[model samples]
Target: MKKFTYENITHAKELNIYLEQGNRVLGALGYTDHSGKHTAKVAMTAGKLLKKLGYDDHTVELARIAGYMHDLGNSINRASHAQTGALMAFQFLRSWGAPLEDIAIIISAIGQHDESNGTAVDPVSAALILADKSDVRRSRVRNTVPETFDKHDRVNYAALSSTLHVDVQKRIITLEVELDEGICFLMDYFEIFLQRLLMYKRAAEVLGLRFKMKANGSKIS
Candidate 1:
């Protein structure tokens, strides 16, 4: 049997189509960029986190795959996208002859990434949750019209830069964001992202790490 890798999943035509369509759907609804850029960022972030913690290569790769495919179900609908994406990924991975155990881990991580109905079930799932929630930046905001910008747009646009730092020695995962206060207030950001940050905290706890958040150089979590 061939070993399935992140490259295989990333280049899959059907999955790529779904990701593009999902991004389009989100764009039409005035949401942030949920396309290849976002998925790739999540994949890299999850893999890096696991790698820093000394996880085996295969486990880190599984986390990467889960992150890449987590938002594919948004192509169908926003509600319950996690569940739908998990089912879709299972079928696709099974068809690719991936091991059942690997499939289970990937799908579980995908399904548990959303803050609405998600938890840190395992290391992969926890990593996925942290990575997905940490992706906030100006580039994510697609709505260019400041006058018509919604809360999500405002918060994302206000973020001039963002970075996720994992310190293996300290067992700390920190999300540092440089916010443009002229664009949006700090309170506005917390109003929209507090729950997501809380989820990140729980996910970090699952990995025996401390999660911290800093906006404009101030620690908020």
Candidate 2:
């Protein structure tokens, strides 16, 4: 079996069509951007997170692949998109001649990346969770009208900047978001993203690291 690299999957033009369609589906559903930009961040962050923790190289690549492909199930439906995307990824990766062992890791990571019904089940899974959940930014907001922004949109739009920092020596991972309180309060962020925060804590635990969140340069949780 040919070894599948992150470059192989990420640069494949055909795979992008699936990602674009999934992103379009999210856009139509009034959700924040799930497009290439978001996936690219997820992919980079996942790989970086694992590498910083000193995971093996192939595992890091698998984490990247899972992150890049994680949201594709949104193309079908938002509900249970994690599981759907995993199945779809399995078929595509298999067709690409990826080994079953590697395919298993990628699919499992994709399946468990969503916070709705997924938890960190492995190193790659933990990396994917931390990477996917911590991605909050104003750029992700797609609503044309500020007056019509929903809770999710408001929270995202309020975010001025976001950075995920991993401190290997301390075994801690922190997600720092700078927000514009004028658009949404810190309370609003917690109200909408509490679940994601809780998931982040658990995911970091799986990686033997502590998870912390800072909003507006202050630790809130």
**TM-score of each prediction:** 0.97, 0.96
Query: Model 1, 144-209: lDDT tens per residue?
Result: 789999888999998888888888889998989898999899999889988888898899999999
Which lDDT tens digits does candidate 2 get at residues 48-140?
Answer: 999989999888988999999999898899999999999999998988998899899889989988877999899988999888888888889
- Residue 177, candidate 2: Cα error in Å is 1.2
Candidate 1: C-alpha lDDT: 0.90
C-alpha local distance difference test of each model: 0.90, 0.89
Q: Per-residue lDDT for 36 in model 2?
A: 91
